[model samples]
Target chain A: MSTKPASERATPWALVTPALLWTLCFFVLPFAAMALTSVTAKDGSFTLSNYAQFFENPSYWRAMVNSLQVTAIVTVVSVLLAYPLAWILAEQVPERFQRLALMLAVLPFWTSYVVRSYSWLLVLAQNGVVNRVLTGSGLFADPVQLANTRLATVIGFVHFFVMLLTLTIFANLKQLSPSYRKAAADLGAGPVRTFIHVILPLTLPGIVVGAFLTFVLAIGDYITPQILGGNNELLMPQLIMMQIGRRGDFPLASALAIILMAVVTVAYLASARWLKIERA
Target chain B: MRAFAKILATVYALLLYGFIFLPVVVLVLFSLQATQFPIPPFTGPSTRWYAAVLADTRLTTGLLHSILVAVGSSLVAVTLGFLSAWGFARFYLPGSAFLRGLITLPLTVSYLIIGMGLLVLFNRVGIPKSLAAAGIGHVVVNLPLCFAIIYSQMGDHQINIERAARDLGASEWKVLLLVTVPVMAPAIFASFFLSMTFSWDEFVISFLLTRFETTLPVEIWNLLRSGLNPKTNAVGSLVFGVSIVLVVAFELLLFRRKQS
Candidate 1:
């Protein structure tokens, strides 16, 4: 690069300064503040007791375990449910109708997310549709408990995320050249074999990306658990919120948040390779 | 076998569609209940809950607050994003990659963490939680998204037109205002709309940062926490209705342009 005049050099700085300052003040500074707070003790001494409490307490660890358990269930279930739906739309639906079909599929996503969760709470209640159908059809001896459970929470999550995964996986499936399938058939691979060997591997990136999104969102969510999961159990977000909301304990909340972030970091590192763009 | 497979796929698609729409269907259905509880056995179709929701001062005011925060924050975010994106795309700035990464990093972090971080910082700095604080949080969450969208669309193709304008004796301001802004209008609009969508629906940050005047989501949360009532359903339905209108408008207007 040639040497530029001072004024010319400052132009980019001037343009970018406002955004950078905002990011620095709000995003970076607060994160640093949280990091600092995480290591501080309640008694005004520098101690890792906040983190120690999380490491030491069974209940605290249980909150993490519950979060992981629910998030894992939601992600895997969403992927499983979404793959075939995406495949059908990609392969079966005519091109003319595919866009319309996809639009309809994700239409519920337009609704407020909090409202949707609350809707699920009602839908899964004892006298809600599922139970009513079961009893009305004599499929069940009596109404079984469904509301305010891990199953309900997972169902609510899977509902929202399945649409997300379908979109990602549908894009992945559509990106496949028909020649890949044709070539596989020419090489004596059956439909299943072609799908397993060629299609699945190709779409893995999309699935991973979508699943990663689900993991992050579901784990950090305070609403879904607070709404549907009920007070029976606590997820990481709930625990973090509980610390801040009930106790006004910033240090403990910060520690829990950092731990949660560390989990997401581990997840990101694992999926980083697949997420990278190919230059070609 | 072919017929059977086709039938199977059709059934599966229908089932999935039903599953996807079930909650929304229930939400709308029960929003009309004459009964107090929003759940179970169909009651009389009543418009009273909707009326009640409209009449409720807190919910109505919260809706206005949501609109204000969403529009206010989105404008700030989009302006900042557009400027930075233009600068990075056009200029030869050192460490630009690092700076862009810094701006985009918040997209990876959860909104809850961002909210918590802001809460801690605000507490430490003695900045009282208010609508402005929540708006700042919204900007923090949205700025990255807007920046990424605009930056991605800032291709080299536009540079030629910009250079032509500069050669015609247009200053940097004139070039940006007339040439660059017009060319990048689609990206800017998309970013603004997307930012609006996110900020409108966003909860935790606004929930934590604001106390007396909160956003619609937090208000709905308050209603939900108070008890299970059809009025909550009515409010949910109302938001859903407005969102659908916006979405349809976006599809017909913006999406058609993209396709063309």
Candidate 2:
């Protein structure tokens, strides 16, 4: 392949150039522009005021705190909820039905993301079905406030991420040969012990990957918080959106976005230590 | 005891399924509501909201814009991704691994951050917010996915075929267009389909990058902010319906062929 003619030597470069250039111009350059803008003040002077503002403002820093809390909650809850479901699909369901079950599990993911949150809003509204059910079934005295709260945001995030984590964990569970389980049983380990020691340890990488993905996506998201969360409390994305949408403050927004990116990078590094983070 | 555990597992699975599908069920059921509110009371099933959604020019235009952006961006993303994937697979280049990683670096970043970066860059560069700008952002997000998918599928088998074609005196362009592409059609098509779906449903980038003539998700967001109406549910159900059809069709047409 390296012994190509002079005219053909540049073919690979030509083939790859468009994508490289596109990524450079649209992705890399824009990111560079954003980083530069984050450090520049309104008057075009170099300043750390935008970054400093996040530290000085309790409300702004509170958004970051809120984001981390919500993301951590969503990641942990989704992984817990999804593991059993993934196990059921992988181990209990007949092999022929596994694909269909997995597809059904993730079916709602195809819904427009905005609409997914809105649907949750409708379901959790004062006059919504959940309220009607609780009231009708005598589960509660009245329709509890479910929508337009941090609870609603967490629920929305968890709902989406459960489907996602289930897929990853399911794939992980499927890849495990029956030999491991058989070997555990042959060694006099009970079902619970086998699962606890062998299965759980084997799937930790998949769990970590899915949990990290849930953390990154749930933290940076704006729609679920905006639609389902109402204006009760702000998250990092909501705070960044506020800077741009309300005040047209790009510097401040960039600073917040960089901070968010930094957090995600830290998460990726943490997770990568446990998992190889390889690409085929 | 085993039977009781089995029954419990079945019940758990059913409950989980119910929780997962609850919002979608509510959304679709309310989309057919005869009245104003999309909330409960089990109103008469009617297509009136769907009719209203179709009637609204803003939504209809937004739908077309979404289709255009999704198709156009996905096509470009797939093309560039395929070419680059072939280049790196077929030919050795200096620092290729680093270059490939650089191309895929966007995959780790959040879409909100990507959108924000573009918004600031476009603002400074005086590029007015439009569908094109949004499409560019969509390409940025989808290109890495396309690259990874297509690159992974470019195994030794395809290279062997390409070598055979070249040995048979076929020109480079001829081999790529006739031999390499057909062999990689399934991968290319899969990447294109995935890219289209991502671009179609992408919200944050389109939200930040477009103005008056925005995409459907942005339009839907406006409808949501304006008020809760059955129209939003109707449109949502419509999108869901269309996406399901596409997924089923792809599964049948592509996966079935591959399996056989």
Candidate 3:
């Protein structure tokens, strides 16, 4: 690179300084503060008991287990449900209506996020739509307990993420050149073989990106579990919220948050190769 | 075999669509129930709940607070995002990639964690929880998104125009304001709109940072926790209706202009 004068070098810095300062003061500083608090005890001495509490307590560790299990299930189910729908839209739907179809798919996403979860509560409640249908159709003799269960929580999450994954996977499918299909056919591969060997692998990056997002969001969410999970089991977010909201226990909350962040960081590093923001 | 495959795909798509629309459809339908509960056996198609929502001063005040925070946070986020995006794209800076990564690192972290970190920091610093504090949390969440979107759209085509403006004896500020900003208006608008959408809908940060004077989502959370009422449904349906209008307008005005 050619050497630039002092004024030229200073201009870029001037332009960038406000953002850097904001990120430093708010983002980085807060993170450091949290990390510090996570190690500090309530009595003011530095201790790792806040984190050790997570390891020693059965309920605390159980919340982590529940979070991971639900997140994994939601991610897998959403992707499985979304991929075929994305394929149908990109491959079989007429071109002129594709935009409309895609818009409809994500339209519900514009609803209030809190409302969306509460709405699912209504749909899965004891006297809600599904239960009413079962009883009316004589499929069951009694109304089932659907609301306030892990199943309801999973249903709410999968509903949201299926829409997200569809958008991503649909974009990936559309990016494929028609020639890939033609070449496969010419090389004697049928439609199923071509899709299995060529299309699915090509779209894996999109799937991984969507699934990673689902995992992070679902794992850290408090509302879906707080509203729908019905106190049957605790998730990490709910446990963290309880510490601060009810007990005024900042140290424990901070420690739990750090642990949750560590899990998300691991998920990110696993999917880092496929998650290129510039290219995406 | 081909026809069978097409039939199977059609049935599957319909089922998925049904699943997707079920809750929303139920939400809207029961929002009009004349009865107390927002559940089954539709009663009168009443306007009582909607009237109740409009009459409630708490809900109305919360709506205004939400709009204020969303607009204020989004503006600050977009301005900082646009300037930094321009700098990174136009200039050659050492460790630019690393710095950019640092700025965008929050996108990978959960909102709950970010809210917790801010809560801890604020508690230590004696900064009382308020709408302004929540707005800062929102900006922290949104600044990265704005930066990424605006940065991606700054391409080489705009560079030539900027260089030409400079060679014509325009000042650096003048060239940027007159030439570069004009060309990047589409991206700027997109980022601002997107930021507004996120800040408007964001819940966790606002919930954690605000006390009594809170945003609509927190207020709605209170309402939800209190009981199951058609009033909550009415407020939710109202929000959904307004959001749909804005989204449609964005799609028509911004997206169509860009496409053409």
Each model's lDDT comes to 0.92, 0.93, 0.92
Q: Candidate 1, residue B162: CA error in Å?
A: 0.4
Reference-based TM-score of each model: 0.97, 0.98, 0.97
Model 3, runs deviating above 4 Å: A1-5, A273-280
* Candidate 1's TM-score: 0.97
| Model 3: per-residue Cα lDDT over A202-246, one tens digit each | 788778878888998899899999999978899999999999999
Model 2: DockQ score: 0.89
For candidate 2, report its TM-score: 0.98
- Give the per-residue lDDT digits (tens) of candidate 2, residues A91-202: 8899999999999999999999999999999999998999999999998988999998999999999999999999999999999999999999999999889999999988
Whole-structure CA lDDT of model 2: 0.93
Report the lDDT tens digits of candidate 1 across residue range A130-229. Answer: 8989998998989878888999999999999999999999999999899999999999999889999989988887787888999998999999988988
Which stretches in model 1 have alpha-carbon errors above 4 Å? A1-4, A273-280
**Top-down DockQ ranking:** 2, 1, 3
> Top model by DockQ, which number?
2
Q: Assign candidate 2 its CAPRI class.
A: high
Tens digit of per-residue lDDT, candidate 1, span B92-126:
78899999999999999999999999999999999
